[model samples]
Target chain A: MRSVFRVVENHRESDWTHTIFFDREIESTPGQFMMVWLPRLGEKPFTLSYLNAVTVKKAGAFTEKLAALEPGDEIGLRGPLGQGYPPLKRPALIGGGVGIAELRLLALASEEPSFVLGGRTADEILFYEEFRELGPVHVATEDGALGHKGLVTELLPVEADSYAVCGPERMMAACLPKLPAERTYFAVERYMKCAVGLCGQCTCSGWRVCTDGPIFPASTVAQMDDFGKRRRSKSGRWEAV
Target chain B: MIPLPRIDPPLINASGILSYPEVFTAFESAGACLGGYVTKSVGPREKPGNENPVVVYPPEGAVLNSLALPTQSAEDWERDLEEIKLKNAKLIVSVYGGDAGEFAGVTRRMSRFGDAIEVNLGCPNKEPGEQTIMESIGQNPALSAEVIERVRDETDKPVIAKLSPNSDYLAVAESCMNAGADALGCGNTLGPGLAVDIRSRAAILAGTTGGISGPALKPINLRMTYEAYARFRCPIVAYGGIETWEDAVEYILAGAGVLGIGTAFMRKSTHEAAALTRDIWEGIQEYLDGEPMSALIGAAHRAAEGGDSHA
Candidate 1:
């Protein structure tokens, strides 16, 4: 299922982040991800910002190369993989940093999506203008440089029909009590090797993130002891989150 | 021959492929279509295995992995197994070791959790010294038998020797049988094969090389299964590149009593994996017509000897 796609656009959002759109599109759902490959550099999982686009941040050597791609550069891609967000009505989307990439599609699909975007400063808040076009947008920055001075959790909307949260695990954990478990969904990440679910590399609490979910309801997240606390390293050893 | 644990469908998940005890619910979801569930290779000590890019798919309809057996300790697995629920399926625990002593220690600790114990004598990725463990023991008849004999001393449950495909497997198979192995897992993955991403000029797998599975290993491992079964006339669990029902039929014709499928599971969901077993079983029944299906074991070999084709 791996195919090469030409980079149609490499939109540099910041010094550390870039959004790359491809020449082709696939039927992908929100919360699902793609394993993006750059020759010799290796493959890594990235949440799709759109069916045809992935927003990446240069966090390591591999992603550093991903940041170097220009228009017409080819990258290997496999998926719209793993389970994605289930349909929701009047969903309130919560995102932190670049993790907002996972929530963009969900926001676009909803008729009246409410977004609470947060980061350390205004510069780190992603997709603010894009989401404002879709629905009401709330902003929070730890530095008090945006709409709200405190955490995004402080700006939670109580009237939404459902909540779709994707961000740091601890932030998602904090949102659990303010939102209903049955109506809240979290798009989590892990060190995934085989996105097809064979390698057991992305297992958390007994659930294969690549198969059972990358998106899980808050109730399911409650049962996972390892959530926000521990994750497996590349060698399969459990390490502190 | 002492009857082994009944694997109702004769199709089981191969060791190291979605076989972690912590996720035994995966096996439950795959359902009654599976005759058995094999655990990842447990060892005396917890192993972290190789680094990332552990698995890769080449365009050749195959998979290469150098996971190097990242296993939890035997103690952790015993604790994990107690919490799992596998309805109506047998459990075949796969265990590996650094040496014969380590193998015995792990088998003694984990054997009680399994209906049968599969000694993983052939893992090509865990290279601790001059040779990988598979090359050290799996390729040597005496070393393979010694490990099996020590494992035999540890448990009363059926012991299966999972040998390597990269060596004189039939000779190793014969030795394992004599060492009191109850059944033969008629070959592990073949060749520490290499796949390179031509543009980067770097190996695709982080380990640089890994065991070859999927379609490429089918013919080679099938021939090994056929020969090993013919020589020992014992139960054989065939592994390597079984994707469709026809492949299952070919292995059964080659004298496999049980089939261990890993690569095919890569392309299927848990729900789809369950359906695959039933599909293959239905295909076998249709191909067998009205004749008893068990009568077809080693039918190809019999045909070669100029005897009744269905004998």
Candidate 2:
């Protein structure tokens, strides 16, 4: 698998910086990611922020190199790997943070969508303009600093065709009540060392995040022992283990 | 990256590391790059394999697996062989069974594939399953010959009997060759071992006992490959803990045509296969090929003759 896009533009979209427009030809569904390798620096995995391609966020040094590249830049990329969200027959796009990327992509499948979004503050929220045509959108924010006080999870869709989410595990968990067991999916951002199944470093206990999955039905997360609870820290120790 | 012979692309992604190459036309790159695929060991019938949590990786990088073989079905390979699209590789099909009839049954079905068939003479986990070929043939030369003889008659393609390292390696290699196999694959994993989890005060694996492989088996695999080369007429496919291009070169020097990488692929995925194959080919082109294949015949010859540097 090779990366086909270059970081054409880079900008901060709040706390998390956004590599606004990379390559339009990336062709990933949503939630799918590309493994980027930087010469001498090593390789890391990032989720595709754009629905049809890769719109990476420039939150760190790795993204900085990608962000600094012009349209003619060449980089190593492999895969639109892992399962992405399937289109909802009806329509409900629910998400937070970069998790909104998946919901926005799902909106491409729907004639119109019910966008239920949230963020940390008013400025942190994104994709409102492009997704507004998808139908109605509801927003929530922590600290009452944005659209609604409390949490983005509070703006769960009351009724809709189906719901898709991406964000902190806690936010996805909060949306469980608003979604049917069969109609919702959450893209798990896991700590995976090797995406191609060899290293065995991404074992979520017995399940392999690389092989078993990165995307599963909402019910699947419920069945997992510690879905969103496990978080690793900088020292190679899991923070919330 | 170490300069080593890259064999083939990684194909099998089964629970352990054994590949069922005959299943798909192409293999995915997980690790190990042999020029061809060696199907996961199979039996004549369906294997329920060991109970759940059949494998356990202890702190020291040791694994204890009691995999009852839990393969789909032996005959399924026949159905899948047609779909396989192998290229420039000598597909070596590995089959495991309780007795000669069952072993031959898999080969007979695979005869049409025209791919070479390997008879798994000894798997450490066989007895408790109510059947075993190891005890019958592996422990005895006459019985081993009978089993190989039976499997040989079933397939028109080359038959390579995979011998166990636990037994007398040279004698076993000889017995299979005498029984009419075209080549020999030595050996299967080392030991019928056990692992204990101190916290639970219980055995780690479901069956409690399994085979040991990886770097631990390299020296022994080298010795056995040498012994098989010295004693047998049929060629030998050196297997066990071969992870580097240098390791593959050593096996080739000690008389292994194709080195079967099991544990390396299990740990690294099959991505190393093509890399290793290319490396070895170039090493040979740079050094080994035009000379007689027999020039690489023994450990003593390699050590004394300087076909390889003493690493």
Per-candidate local distance difference test: 0.82, 0.60
TM-score each candidate.
0.88, 0.55
- RMSD, every candidate, angstroms: 3.3, 15.8
**Per-residue CA lDDT of candidate 1, range B94-140, in tens?**
99887888899999998888999999988888533335779878889
Q: List iRMS (one decimal) for every candidate.
A: 2.6, 15.1
- Please give, for residues A1-241, the per-residue lDDT of candidate 2 as tens digits: 3334555655555555454465556766666666665443434666666542444556667767765656555555656666666666666777776667556556776665787777777665677777676687788877676577878666655687666777777777667766788988767776544354433334443344544456667776676555656542211123464
Off by over 4 Å in 1: A3-27, A38-41, A50-53, A58-61, A64-75, A86-89, A176-184, A217-233, A237-241, B1-3, B30-32, B126-130, B282-293, B307-311
Model 2 lDDT at residue A158: 64
> To one decimal, what is the Cα RMSD in angstroms of model 1 from the true structure?
3.3
Q: Give the least accurate 10-residue stretch of model 2 chain B, judged by summed lDDT.
A: B1-10
First chain of model 2: TM-score? 0.84
lDDT of 2 at A38: 47
Q: State each candidate's clash count.
A: 0, 40
Docking class of 1: acceptable
* Candidate 2 ranges with C-alpha deviation above 4 Å: A1-241, B1-18, B22-33, B59-62, B127-132, B267-294, B297-311
**Per-residue lDDT for A1-241 in model 1, tens only?**
6677889999888888898999998788788888898765677888888788888888889888888789989888888788888889999898988888778888888779888888888877888888888988889999999899989888975578899898888888788788888999988788887778887667777677887788888998888888888877764556788
Q: Scoring model 1 with DockQ, what do you get?
A: 0.44
